[model samples]
Target: MAMDFSNAALPAHYGLHFTPTFHSKIPPNIDPTSTTLPNPFIVVVTGAGKGLGYHISLAYASAGCSGLAISSRTSSDLDALASEISKIAEKRGTKIEVLKVVADVQSDSDVSNLEKEVRQKWGRVDVMIANAGVISKYVEAPSSSGSNLPRGIVQDADWARVLDINLNGVWRVSKAFVPLLSESKDGPQALISSCSMAAHSTISELTPIAYNVSKVAGMRLMECVANDHGEEGVQAFALHPGAVVTPQTKNHAGGQWSDILADDEGLAGAFCVWLTKEKREWLSGRYVSCNWNVKELEAKKDEIVKGNLLKYRMVV
Candidate 1:
């Protein structure tokens, strides 16, 4: 288990020290529905059939993005999401071309096919949201279970599967779509992946060991992407979409953490739009939480960059 660090003890820039008034909901400054994106902008979101993915796609459509390509493993879910996007376009007296694709991130062929389809339709991608991820069954501590059964990462049958989908999946999407982002005629090309605080937390009771390790490795991958691709005009970010409960989370350990999952589903979606809406290169390649107030985050820009904060590093 990791150390039991307290959020209140962390710095203001970490965003865990927010007042009661400014928790996890979407703030007015970065609300997508009230914002307008540039013309001819195109975005691709994976695992977008439901949950935070659905809301993120909706935010782009609400912001008047020119085109959107959303993918998921379920065809029915894509159909439902597409219908909602159409409704939003009509209501706002705007037009948004929605392309739906069915894909499993674990499959190389499926991910390639998704990239091919998007390239054929839009010829370029402005933003890529690699949001497909999965968690393994809980691995109880040896002390908790009476039997001497295996425990933690070594014991979980689905350990490899979680890393494959959560960590390697991010790599697959990045490998396929980053080139298209570079082809964009606009500014601020970005690749944002759904990450979690579990990357830094060691609370075994809250999540499985595989989930925690995959998140840590995933953030490191984001950092590597930023270092390698910043010269190519592609900015990458690891995003901790606020603690919102969806089908994925509700079933975890029979809803054990449901009480703490109070963030609005719209928070992360709006934050994505706000992140890539303009070129804030200073914040690229860092870990950001949707629950953080953007205004306060902006205020710490100089300190963040100067101190090289938010990226993982050894304390010693």
Candidate 2:
């Protein structure tokens, strides 16, 4: 599928009364100073061992966040990332505490234990980035093969594995952490998402049904959290961090797609940093790409709600 980065069309639901002029003055990268604003905020980043998670952790560190808890399946990778961030903080003359936890996001016990540790260390958490995800072979393939499993033909084991970490895992972590975030005087919970172009476009051949379903499920989770907790000062956002050239994508790409993935990594990383900034609240519960805020997509809010209801029904 061809990717278009231009900002030309706006969905009618955005309630955009006027066509805003595109400005070249928008900073190409996130200003580190914006992250250091008052109120020491504690952040927890899942899947922080590599890829977008690694960069997101650094963004928080640059902002002088109080402390960060990094979690991934591999302890060594998490420790290495924490060590690098520690050095960066030291050079900046800021104290950013780093905690490494090895946990499989798929397991309830793991999520529970990680939450307990964080609550013990810091009574409150300001940000929770539910970023851990796995793209199984079904979703990672370049195209569907004749012998390939049916679309959405997720095996019992694959279903368990994907939903466990992608959907249920996020729920477990979010539910566990909400109490801590609620304790905070100021509340902001950001849930990071990958590109949801599949949700918007019919690319079943290029994208797997399971992966699309998982991401769409993820977006709804954020919305439900926002609706339930917004009045309490907790705001939730679902962010599409663009395409980043990561090890996972590298293993999935076949031909030209490989080059596209490689080129998008840095741009995507920069965009994720910018999206985490304070100004992104405007794009809450909506799909975003290439720094383009798809607030118009918010019109389908009811559909998102319905999708969540159906998913819960199936799970229950």
Candidate 3:
């Protein structure tokens, strides 16, 4: 069996091996509005209509990113997000060119259209966050009667739909954006995918098999990207964006799991900005959690590298 990266299978002292220190909000050091990124930096974020995606775009805009490309299937959501970003830019007295595109990750042509728009507008991409994802419909939740409902197994179509969006969708974005990342000259060319702690879960009652398997596979896929593109100065990472309450999770388990979602929604966005603020190649191809304390993580860099922790492997 694979020795997964879950808490039970790893050392406790390592922050990532256990539940990280809960950060309910963006810290001062990583606050985008306070800490500005370099000029001419352009970023592309998929699924930017709401939830984590919305916050991430806001964080980038607040940080004063020069160019921002946000894609969502819903045009109205994109319009609203663009307006909010404009307000942020005005408040900060920074000019951020916001590109709102209606594109679905599930469609090859739509993703291609997103890429074309970015290439035409800026001709390069400094950071790409493949954040588009979905949860399975067949979940274990509390029925109105207050009794634990039976966990329904995900159907074949439901399983395929999850993988198509969560795993294959990431692949589509990577294929369409890596060339632009290579063209970037003044920014950190980083590719970050939103993986999850659920990637390590085996309990079907807690997470659907499709979501679980897709995340696991997506983590490995990012590893492959790092290995394949590191020489090109393109750093890649798979990230667990912390346990925040999103539209997807607000009613998860019929609010039975609300307590776990108390984490700050903006934590992941700040973390992403920090991750790509500079090139720390040591962390490429690894799995990182947004909730991990940055100071502690920095202190443990040598040990982490020497031991080659924060990766997927099989233990004897």
Candidate 3, residues 1-316: lDDT per residue as tens digits? 2113333553443344333454667777778778788888898999999999999999888888999999999999999999999999899998999998999899999999999999999889999999999887742444443323223363323788889999999999999998888778567899999999766766554556788889999989989998898888888899999888887776555433655576788999999998898888888899998887777777878987899877888877
Show the lowest summed lDDT stretch of 10 residues, model 3. 143-152
Q: Candidate 3: lDDT over CA atoms?
A: 0.82
Candidate 2 stretches with Cα past 4 Å from truth are 1-29, 33-35, 138-157, 187-195, 262-282, 293-316
- TM-scores for the candidates: 0.90, 0.75, 0.90
Show model 3 residue runs off by greater than 4 Å.
Answer: 1-21, 139-157, 254-256
Cα displacement (angstroms), candidate 1, residue 33, comes to: 0.9
Task: Give me the displacement of residue 98 in model 1, in angstroms.
Answer: 0.8
Native-to-model Cα distance after best TM-score fit, residue 124 in candidate 3, in Å: 0.7
lDDT, candidate 2, at 314 = 28
Which of the two, 1 or 2, has more TM-score?
1
Which segments of candidate 1 are over 4 A away from where they belong?
Answer: 1-15, 18-21, 138-151, 253-256
